[model samples]
Target: MAPQVDITVFPGNIVNNEFAATTTTRHAINPSTGEALPEVPVSTKDDVDVAVAHARTAFKTWSKVPFAERARLLLAFANAIEENREQLERLLVLEQGKPLGLAKMEFDMGIQWLRTFATMEVKDEVLDDNEDRIITQTFPPLGVCCGIVPWNWPVLLGLGKIGPALITGNTIIIKPSPFTPYCDLKLGEIGMKIFPEGVLQVLSGGDDLGPMLTEHPGIDKISFTGSSDTGKLVMQSCSKTLKRVTLELGGNDPAIICEDADFSVTVPKVATMAFLNSGQICMLVKRVYVHESIYDKFRDAIVEFTKTVVKTGDGFEDGVLVGPLQNSMQYEKVKDMYADIKHQGYKMALEGHAMTNSKGFFITPSIIDNPPEDSRIVVEEPFGPVIPLLKWSDEDDVIERANSLKMGLGASVWSKDLDRADRMARELSAGSVWINSHFDVAPNVPFGGHKWSGIGSEWGMTGLKGYCNSRSIWKWKKVM
Candidate 1:
């Protein structure tokens, strides 16, 4: 039986293994109905200072604890999350505007990530082992980490940063997006039962809290996941203190469908990536490039598939695969893009459904058919359920166009010929490239971005290294 956790109960900041209330509070809106849910506490500068001081104090012992013991505690934390999975899933759907099914997937993946990070160990590298002298290198954890998690996939991304930082012996204070902070706060509450006081904490606030944490001297490192523009600001802020930073920013990813691609299989896969989670994912496929030879067939097939298969409504309603945009700001931005699409006289191949006189920030999925390469929908990432399908007659030209963007987070190629697909995938300048698949991510893979996409890695060994400092030790065996 599921735990009787109240899905409607709003939580405050988790600092020093306790719930800390704030003088100011804000209401979290339900994206499904545009109704206010409950009051979420907004942390102040004092809260940050207190949290940081506690973390610094806790780091003294947490960093010295045996790695095996840390692993055991992390596993216990994962188990606690599993026990309250149903409550977390419902909270995620209500706050993040994703289907309950996707929320469950996110929670499951988050648990798996914690387990994976627990098993990983950073061993010392021996450079020399001579009789006269010995040389070795080791990784020491940074003092205190600040993980700034975005609203999209809050559970997975939050754990992505928290797992590596904690496993590598660094204490972290998570600042969840105000748009979706309930589940993360609850996560912090759950973690407090397993981890030591101040080892893992969460602070909930609005725009002001982010700058306070990022610019705070107490924070040794900042792992930020957000838009490219905001990432630039974060990098600039961290530069002032020379703090280590790992940024996983925005992406305008492209998917190239080769002439020999299997239309039946490729079309649905591409559509899923383009429309899933209402296309709010940073690494989602925002642009589709189809060879001119079969562009028409691929376009028509995707349109028909989206119309028949994709459902849009409240997440609680049965068969609703797509929910409203997580917030009103994003809803207005996508609406502006829609207006621009009309002004530019672009043809929409499949406008799934018209916008209704609804209360929530809802938008029906739409596909732009063969928009110009430089068009807004093609060049800029909508970050919504709108995708642009373009025609490409030449492989070289298509690859060039795909690589032209400054944001190279993830890309995919679809082709029956393994050699052809592999060759094309190699040419795309993205952190994660897939052939005949899209959005295939794992906890063990080192996922980051190229160019303006991001600065550091998030998962795998590279991600763990991001939270630590390298030190070389030279020992003299004989007295000199």
Candidate 2:
């Protein structure tokens, strides 16, 4: 029997004020069963205005609070979230359809970001070795920021934006994706307990409330994470106001399995990384490039491994390796891509199979053999359980080919020669390079892309730069 998960709707807050009452109703459906778990109230533009107004007023004082005080409150917020992580994890599993363990791990990592960023010290010092000279670059918040996060990993992504923004002394208004707004709202409530009213807020709705949040002059900066298409739209929207923006966009990450690479090692790791989170992760290995010598063996190994590792079932099951697609649109898209690739003459080493007795959006992991370099599935990101293999022999040739894509988010190299793999990783045109690993993220380490993969970094001291305006201060010293 599938686990029974229930959601309780909490009213979305436009303004971060004391919660007097819950006065709205909307339901978030569990995509696996197609049942509404709980009804969460949707916020409108007026709500966003109210939220921003409160934050704008709060910024006057919040920004003045000593950096130490702000850091203290940030740690407090992290503590509150940590205490209720299991409850948050349960809700995340219900709405997002990721495995329960993965959800919990994500929550933990999100808290780690909060803790790490809270203690980050921005210092000012002398620029020269001169004994009588001084220079400083003090960090200051960008007033009120609007954080727009996607539904895939709402808690973690939201923290990636909010953690830096908040610790830097900026008040925040988060507009969470409608697909999973409950967790955002609940997290906001927990934040309010530690933070002063208006320091943090959550607004929930479809796409309607985005314009007001981004275009509002009161919002000093915007941090967003989602598709490149959406990132473009947001960039245009924020342009008119000329607001500061940070965007973490889409990725079609490619893994190059070299001729000298061990198939036994690369095949299994790439297969798991490709389909982790049901291939919903932006950095998930979307395409695999193998040398022709090992293509056949790599294909067979990946196909066999994917079959055993990924399970087709509702998300609520205990041992389900992969859950439903989280929505019907994604389900159709994955299925369509699989069919298209097969029709384009690529062999379907593994065909995607839908569930026979369930209404949930489940699809089997699929592998396409020797797909053309320019094939639709190879060029485009499926963002689903589909892996299309491409063949390449010359290292120089393949590196040139891999760098061809406009999306330079991430890449991975697999080989027994660590030095060779490291060199390739450095040469790959990507913001992040992994040797023998994929989907590895840490809070202290910066993450972003060079080309269309993203606009700016999202975590670490570098990420804090996005939420701040850098000013170099110098005092002219007179030698009398």
Q: What is the TM-score of each candidate against the true structure?
A: 0.98, 0.94
Which 10 consecutive positions of candidate 1 have the poorest summed lDDT?
1-10
lDDT of 2 by residue, 304-393 (tens): 888886676665577666777777777788888877875777778888766647767777788887777888888888888888888898
Off by over 4 Å in 2: 1-7, 20-25, 129-133
Residue 8 of model 2, lDDT score: 63
What is the RMSD, in Å, between candidate 2 and the native fold over all Cα? 3.3
Q: Which predicted model would earn the best lDDT? A: 1
Residue 448's lDDT within candidate 2 is 94
Quick one: best TM-score, which candidate?
1
Query: How far does residue 300 in candidate 2 sit from its true spot (Å)?
Result: 1.3
lDDT of 1 by residue, 1-480 (tens): 322345677567899998899999997888988888788889999999999999999999999998999999888888888999987898899899998878888998999999999999887999999989999999999999999999989999999888999999999999999899988888898888889999999999999999999899999999999999999999999999999999999999999999999987898889888888988999988999999899998889999989999888887777776788999899888888888898898899976443577788889999998888888998898989999999998989999999999999999999999998899899999999999999988888999999999998999898899999999999999999
